[model samples]
Target: MAQRLGALDLLILLPDPELGILRPAPGFRQTLPGGSTWTELLGRCAGGGEFRATIAYPDVQRLSPADVFITPDGAVLMLIGGQPRVRASELAGAAGLVLALLRSEAREDAASASARASGDVTRRATALASSLDRARADLAKNAAALRDALSDAARLNDELRLLNETLEQRVRNEIAERAKAEDALRQAQKMEAIGRLTGGVAHDFNNLLSPIIGSLDMLVRRGVGGEREQRLVDGALQSAERAKILVQRLLAFARRQPLQPGAVDLNQLVRDMAQLIASTMGATVEVRVELPDDLPPVTADANQLEMALLNLAVNARDAMPGGGMLKISAEPEQVIPGKSHRLRAGRYVRLSVSDTGVGMDEATLSRAIEPFFSTKGVGSGTGLGLSMVHGLALQQNGDLAITSREGAGTTVDLWLPVSGAPAGANDGPGNAAEPLRGSGTALLVDDEDLVRMCTAQMLMELGYRVEEANSAEAALRLLDAGLCPDLLVTDHIMPRMSGAQLARLLTSRIQDLPVLIVSGYAEADGVPAGIPRLCKPFRQAELAASIAALMPTTAIRRRKDVRQ
Candidate 1:
């Protein structure tokens, strides 16, 4: 009947009444995937409970017969088939007939056992006890296997959860890093555009200011007017000086201002400015200095550094309207490559100004160094303080760093490279005495009529016969026409030939001719190396000092005689 039904061989499975689990009878081997037992597989099936009920109650009338049937002795008969060749009802009837035969055989066995019951009762009891012991052993083994499987599944789940969390965190970090890089690129581009525009405007402004400042300075020094008139001149002069300072600040932010970089003693500079800082901060604020005695000198412009410090102090004072502690400190630092985006790997001295006051939020701090971006009320600030400092740092191969929190405080650090040379003796303030007088022909060349007239007057006032030229070519023509000047002062950035180029050409032609190249901006390649330079909008005294430094009294006299 099994062969006719096209099913696999019929198997009889007995239900363990004690454990309520199914076990194939001995000599039957059935295996499932992952080595799971048939008992575990069937227990997880949807109809598993009903199938077990049919096996346990074999004596009851069979309600429905399907692929599975039961015998009278609590045995399950399974017909495993890929496809049945006959109807399911026919199979069920045939299985019933088989079950009936088995039931009859079970009854015969029971009857035979009863006949021998008196003699074999003790032996029967012994056999049944041994089978119970074997069942107990099998149950213990199955429980241990289930426990190990559950433990493995739990461990795997924990590892998977941890991996997902780590991946999420890494993704978040990558996104944050990308955002920071984009912000930096945008900032650099904006600053570059502003610097170019500011630099050009400042250059033209400096030219116009030179003659005004120089004329006003002369009028004030020589006492050319009455008491009331003098006061007016002083007022005008004072206003012009203030204008000069503002232009310088703009130039500094543009990175076009010339800087006289030298080794500067940081400790001494801070000590000298302590009184000034205290006075500026006023009585409400407490000022503290924390500079180490053994601090190394840095390479920077002394005057510019002082100005930067003053600006920071003023900013701190404004931040603390109700007054707070302002701390100035310096320390040495070493940076390695790839450690910083703006700084190169080297030794640096970190000069920091920290204030206990209302600080900036992330939005404000991001644009703190942008030109003309100020939080102060109208007319209270120029908004170039931080940007000027930042430009100074970049010009000097340094960097600026800022840290701030909304309600905490702000710290600004100016990191400058450590100077290899010791601080020079001439790095201090200049002498306040009168400028030296010279007796010789001094050539003054500039393209602007007002600037040339103003500078020539300053030269004539210095006791030298002044020769004026409107351009470098004109100056060259004067030299070619047998006019030998003891001193040659020319303005840089003129048409046709620059001051530095003219100086180079004249030096090759004449010997012992002192040349001073003056300009508004710091054109590194515009001027030849080893030539003396003077920044534009110079006072009579500054001009005299630069001239005297180049051509001393003895040198000037000697050069005049050689020309004679």
Candidate 2:
């Protein structure tokens, strides 16, 4: 019986605490003290004591003072100092009387202890299984989070790459656009230069046309004393003169006219133009001339310079339709040393035309110098006046400046280089000498048949033997074939070879031969510097005067020698 109880105690301490068996103790059939068989009492006491000892003598050696007990007949009980704390005593007594009861109850307790141990083992295994399932669920959640993070990283990388490509493309497009803009700006500047050249030629040719047209109209009205032959001559002259003026205007716009530069006093010129402005603009617009006493003389075409001033005054008049002041002034200034003004250190005569009228803003001012760019309504103005002024200033080695504000009005300043005074007093129009008699042999080359014939007749009337050629090639052939005229007179534009080329060729052959260039446009090619020039539609007297003025004189001969 002791050995069986000892085995039961060892079983309770196993790693699986609930896996054990209990049985009736052998050779102890009679009931012991307290009305219970010895085997039954020993079984109950031993199982409870073993469980209590395990709890009390935990491997760490601290014991709880609580008794663990099992009752006979398969009932569990706890005792406090040998008093029953469970209601299993009545059931144990009813199972059998004394000895029989104790023996039967021992058998039942051993079975109950075995059953209780099995139930505890089953419950523990269930708890371990639930823990494993929870661990698997946590691992799956971690894996899903890691995968999502990787996917997000890949998407962000793609977006960054696309953004980089877009930025690069935009940069390339901006560079191309800037290059196109620069090219367009250059082309606009070239066209503007061409327009100014055109305006200057028209202004000068118009002056020459005034005299010719006036003379022709007079002759036609008088009818040359009314004879049919005289009438035909007058009609022909009048028609030819009108046609010549039209052609001159066209050539001037094309910048092919020949210029005749001379000394001009800007202060005097402004004063003279002021009178005309006063009369034309009427009493409504005041014409004021503010001339500086120390104004320097500029080298330019005097007539053209006067015309430029008159054009500006007229423009100022039109600007102030409600009437305003037209101020023309002249001053002496030094060319400021800078890259903007390509002038060297020298004296300059500043001529200004200002007005108190509606002005221009930045956009209009930028396009102001362009030919045919006008703010005035259609049919109100031709838009060539300001451009002409710009060209004339440039031709005289000067600069033009414009300043304007939207409501503050505008001012135009023309800077001309200073020139030394003439040796003697200037011969005013009436005091000039009569046209000289010229018997020199002259070659006249012009593309226009009427111009050629008219020019030839004028030379003949002036007592010169005149030969005519319609083209530079024909003129060159005549000269090459030993037709040496005393002077070469040629129009600038021709079908083959220009007048300048002919002049250059002739110069090589006869080094001292004088070439007089006649053109409606002053800027035409091959019109050599320092040569005498006559604008078209010139009267017989003007033509004769130019030829005589250019005729080799003692003074000219000396100057030529000095230059050589």
Candidate 3:
């Protein structure tokens, strides 16, 4: 009933009605919008005339040219088709056939419309399915992104929790460290206060003993030749000497001793004392001295160092009882600034004494360097050895460290700052110094009557004119009153202005004046350096020697100006 025209069109099987009538389809004498219509075509081919025409309807595109024919019932049939060069006479017998064909075309058109509607529905269903798939994919992506975001948030929370915990722990540690530092500072302050108190007591005690020792020395020198007298004198002198030793030990522990620091060869000093150390530790104990040749010189008092070594050896021997090995070594050490506890940063020569013997416990080791903290039996030790050594090290701007475990041996390290100069063999006390006598006008100053009396007598006995001033203030008055002497002798620790200050003031008035200082154990904070100092609890021989030494250095600037 129909033929395919293209993909979306069809051609109906029917002859044109206008061809059968030999005219255009009937109309009411009207024209198509585009210029031509069925009415004009009919006029051209009326009265069964043999003619053809084209009617165009540009705006009505769906109004196709219709094939027309008359049916058996005299009804007109119209369909869409085309025939080329057909006469109007030929359409009379073809009407029934055309009508039948038109009927078939109507059925075909109905079937085609049904198929097109089905196709439209199928296309709409496909588009909906694709849109649904896209929506599903988008939902899946959104879910995955949500999951990823949650995971990231979880990780961030964990990191924040860890950071918070770390900050809390760090804060706790900082507070603990701050508390420890404060406690350490308090302890240091307390120890310094105690040290000052101890030093003051020791100084006063020495001052008290000075007169007794001076008087005894003078009597002994005056020739007490009787056997009983000599023995008693000797005994008294020995006792006085012991007391002086005790005072000196106290001063050493207090770190108030004026040290005569010099460049010392630690290697040579240790080597020289090895024999004595071996003998003193007993035949059972073996002494080993390891002094490397390359070690630098240390600036400290050599005698104090020797005494420290002897003390360490004695301690080690006592710990062994039966026997042990005493190892002594010297080497260089490096210290960092501000970080080195109790010592300034510098290159130091470490003199270490290692002993293989019964070591001390933690409690004992903690107080090992404390004065009077001793484990030795009664009358066996003075308990001031290690304390003295500690003080000596500190006085030299150094530090001491002791490491010991309960059963393992002990090691004592003495770290002294290294001297710039190379080590020198300055051993063997220089030329046995004897007491020298000199006659000159001497200015003697003291705050105490007894010590001053004893000293003045000793000077007069040595054949010198002595002038006495009870105090620095009184001495200044004497100088103002024009009492000039050949030698100026003064006690260091005096009331009001110190003896050193007085000497400085007097030196300004009298140029090239010889000043001699007599001290017990005082700090050199106010005392001027390069001035000769004589320690108290001294004998006439020592006093004479000290004065003799100062006499050569401008003792009598103007001999004629002496008053006494």
Candidate 4:
């Protein structure tokens, strides 16, 4: 039983009246303290039935009197040392077995009983050892299985963590794409609104500039002053011309300017500009023009395209403060449907200007085509170069694309629609013709008194008798009152009646009457087709050119020769 319980020693005790203390059964020895009696030990564990106590035994090497089990009928079973092998609830069954052994030993004579007890103990110890070995093997197997389960759980946890991270990254990317799309929509809306506002402002500004330019032009052309005075007048005229160009740029940005789209030899244009670009960019910049021999012609405004190229070249020159290469190249591209959002699906010629210079970052590139948005210092730039080029491209049914990265370089692509017609289809009467000298009545109409006055002077200078009206209604009234003019020149935008409305009315009443419509900006819906249009802020020569073209013959006469 001691071997089964894993205890160092076991004892069965009974009270002895002669000793007045508890004594072990015959053939057994007491292992408790010398002074300890059964009465004292029982007193320490009083009031608890079938109880176990941890009694200290200093004289012995054992750390604990492991279990002191009191059996029924005044018999005690005790275990010394080691933890109790059986639970408190199972201690009763162990006590019963111990009590049976004690009873069996007590039934025989002392020597014979001792010999029988020794044999029984040896047999029980052997069986208990075998049971202990089997229990150890089962415990080891269960421990290994638990370790495997823990390892699998850890691996699964790691895989689940990786999946969660991937999902989070994808969500972040989706959010970023949504934000980028929203930003693009907002920018487009802003540009549209700005275009409308600038168009109107440019119209009014051009109206104001016309009289100033016309008067200055008259002064400079007539040579009406001394050399010093002539120089001052020429300077004033130059300044007015500068303002006119500025207004043109504003009109371009608004997409309200008229464009003369013609089949242009893109390769030839670049080659012709090569020397000019080189000179303009200084010797520090090396200019290179790379164009394929068989590059197709593109449809675009030749003059505006030239300006766009020049602006890009100048910008490239400014970017390379130290020096760099400027390359102008052209290539054919075929855009497929649904492949691009900015450009229409068609054949196109891509005119690109590349520069090995300091480039713009994302923030700067986003605003690069916005009017008046410049990176240069104040007063150094008007900030309309890229915007004008962009607007011109749009007006020609084309598109502009810019690619740049900080510290790398920049490339600007102007995509023009491919033209079926050969180049120079609209190059107009080759050389500058002599100014038209007319001798007839010119019915000049305008709402602004100063603009009317300026036009009247320009007409008089061109040797034409002028009849002025404050509005289109007045011009119609003049025609209704039996006044037949040789020609009609009128501003497009007027109160009550537009220039186009007047021209239509007059054309219906009087056939073959030469008409010229002048305006600050192109109002395609308001203007009548087939009538010659001369843009406002024109000099006398420009006015003469329009008249000469509208009535190619020097002598022009009306069907009815009545005068006011």
Candidate 5:
């Protein structure tokens, strides 16, 4: 039968089977179809299972036998001629409506599930982005901290460099200051030595001058006409000669006397000094000489060495108040290395003066070489003995060392540079002694009135024409007035012009004039280079010998007539 569908037809068919399957919809198709199948028409018409039957003939027109049944829910029953009557439900319209409702519900469920999944994906992406930002912030913080640390380290390095430079400058300045201090100390020591020698010479000069002046006063008052007067004058002249000898000794000790350096044998020197040492020590102290046969000669001033040995001998004798042995010996020695003894390295001749007497402690020994330092009581000792020895040792490029203990004894060793040749025998004391002799026109110049007058009187007695001047200016005036003497004897240390200056001026006027300078002070600074020196407080004999030695009769007779 050709059917017509109603709303009841949708109810008789099965609901769409695809309604439970959900899937991702395409971009353009979001909704499904409502009713497109015949099954939908059947479901819309059927309500319950009841139906009615009907039949109709097409050609014959007669009263038809037909039965039609209808159920309460719109089902119908029909009968045919040859078959039993059948029943069926018609629900085409009703089934179609139900299919449309189920399709709409399925589309709504798919849209809801898609919305939930999109929210979950968005949350995961946001969390990942936040973690990346945090990591970048941490890197920036670490970089800034590293830069600040580097800057601080560079500043500290600059400060240390400046500090190092300042320290170096400070060290250099300290070294310069120390060198200056040492130089000043050496100069002070030299001056102190000179002062002590001056004091000793002056004291001895005054004593000798007192007696000579007193004797002259008596002779002048008594008149110069008698043999007795001449004898008294001669006695006074002898005292003056003693004074001159003392001055020469002082100059030798001071190193101002011209040194004639030559090779001198220490062994021979000590042997030659034996008798003098014995005579000076007398019967109290026994003298012994231990001269080595193989001892070498030394290069030094012979006269100065003799005087030094005598001084040491006298000192040794004085040390032994009670009679004791004074032993003098000579040997070869090598100075200990790396030790500062003020002597250079070389073969040396060591001369030792040992005494069995009361010795000295460390404090006393340290000051033994110092000028004016002495253990002897005042008025008994001049204290220049050891000082003179020390000066002589240094002047000769040698050194002196002393070893002693309290109440035991003392040993003084003098080290001198050795020479190649053997020493010659020294002349005996009696054979070497010579009386003073002179005959010439002599000019005596001295700052002190007593020294000038004493020197003049000695020259007159020695058969010389003498002119006296109390100062260098007076001597120059005398020379200008056509008074050309054969010899010019002047004091080295004077108030205005020194003896060296006077000699220069005189020698310029008269080239061949002989000059002899005398002074208690031994400084060679103001003394002429080549002029012969005679120290102050000299004796008549010493003055005569110096005058005669400088101006021999043959030379004097030739120059006596040359005026101005």
Candidate 6:
């Protein structure tokens, strides 16, 4: 049975290796000299030789049968692929006709020679001429048959050429279609990433705002409800403090958070986080700290590093919902250039948090550090935890790497660059004090009206007569008019002129006047060096400390009316 495989109407054989020998061939076969190769043998056999054989399937270990037949003009037909399009009977008939023409030509040649040699007079001449006439007529009939055969071959050739062109076009169309699909997939991925970022941001902010709003709303109702009212105010303060942390994390991810980069003891940091991890992760999850005190110190923000550790701990807790061991360790490492995108070539403190839990697969692990991507269900977690840690590592000239195996465990490595200097004591949260008061006027600038009003009120509580400006240019106008204040406090991000640009301009003109830039995050390089900065959503006490640090020239004026 003929399989009739391949789009080709006819295939000419030329022996070659498979995989490498998957070459295109023209339909016409050319006779090669007698050889052992299948193609050569097929040609010889088809040249009216009595032979038949099976051969190897081009370099592959299989046998394919080949049938051969010779054409009148000494061409071979290899039906190796068994294509049923060309019929053996019809071709054989054409071959027979061609054979007859050859025979007639030979006979005519012999007759001409004999007639020339004989001295025949009138009778021989008449008989020879009649025979010549009959032969000429027969030659003409064969010539017409040959012409029809040539026309058929030409038509077949045109069809094969059109098929080849169509096949090439289809291949090009397939490539184009695949490219379009890939582009679409990339775009969809980008949009999904954006959505995750926005969702997580909103979630973190809303959670922080909920408690603060609830507490303040209760405190503001009617009169002071005594102790209950105090508790409400306390709750509001706690919520606001938490909100500040969330804002700092957001700033860190943006690479705008200012870090007080100094030598930090990795061993001590891990030790401190152990108890927190144990308590927070519950009894089912065990906590372990493996840190060598001899490990070198890494340059980073102490508070931010602590925050990062806490985040990793929380992440471990979420992973091990069924209980597992969480290990925190620190060691020295030397990174190569381009080894880690965040850290360059340098000695670093490798701080790691590993957990024995059901770990992440490749797909989930890849997007683990992406903002708002979390395996935990909504309301269970904000996906920003690992992302914030990643951001902190980057801001501190460090890199964050994750290793995980499904159903085995996960490990997050924080490679922080080592500093030669010894670690210093970090600031502690002390008892809250009254807002520092000042006699001189102060200038406050912000783009938002409500924020400006609130900040001005805080300054007023601090006993400074506050002036307001909606923008940086407007703030400069106040100065141009000779309305000099003790200090300048402005927003970091703004339209037209940013706080950093405004600060540079003010410093040149005001000479000694102090400036404070307040925002969620300021670009690490953009803000001027050595100017004191206070983060946004701050308390009156924080505002006082910042103002006192910057504007020492403003004479102290204690407000007796301030509540304890």
The top-ranked prediction according to lDDT is 4
lDDT of each: 0.78, 0.62, 0.73, 0.80, 0.63, 0.68
User: In angstroms, how far off is 537's CA in candidate 3?
Assistant: 1.6
Give the better candidate number (4 or 6) by TM-score.
Answer: 4
Candidate 3: tens digits of C-alpha lDDT, residues 336-420: 8887767788899888899889899978986787777789889998888888888888899998899999878999999999998
lDDT of 2 by residue, 215-256 (tens): 564465456655887767677776767556444434433444
Per-residue lDDT value at 274 in model 4: 91
In terms of lDDT, the poorest run of 10 residues in model 2 is 7-16
- Give per-residue CA lDDT, model 1, range 449-472, as digits (tens): 998999999988988898999998
Give residue 20's error in model 1 in angstroms: 40
| Tens-place lDDT digits, model 4, residues 459-526 | 98888889999888888788877778888998888888889998888877777888999889768896
TM-score of each: 0.69, 0.54, 0.71, 0.70, 0.53, 0.62
Model 6 weakest lDDT span, ten residues long: 1-10
Indicate the worst ten consecutive residues by lDDT in candidate 1: 53-62
Poorly placed runs, candidate 6 (over 4 Å): 1-237, 338-342, 425-435, 553-564
Which clashing pairs does model 1 show?
none
Best-fitting candidate, scored by TM-score: 3
Estimate, for each residue in 1-564, the C-alpha lDDT of model 6 and write its tens digit.
123322122333332344433122322333322235565564464446434456554334555555555454444444554444444333455434334444454465565567666643455556556655665566556545655775798799999999999999999999999998897688557745654464356334533443354335335443467887678777766766666666666656655566778777777777776777689989999888888869987788888888888888888888888998999888898888888654688898888899998999988986787766789987887677887887778777778889999999999998888988877644445535444565767788888776677677667767888899999989878877777676788987788998888888877766676789876555666777777787656555567777766654446433221111
Where in model 3 is the C-alpha error above 4 Å? 1-139, 223-232, 334-342, 422-439, 552-564
Q: Give residue 234's lDDT in candidate 2 (0 to 100).
A: 76
Off by over 4 Å in 1: 1-176, 425-439, 555-564
Alpha-carbon deviation at 234 in model 5, angstroms: 11
> Candidate 6: which pairs clash?
none
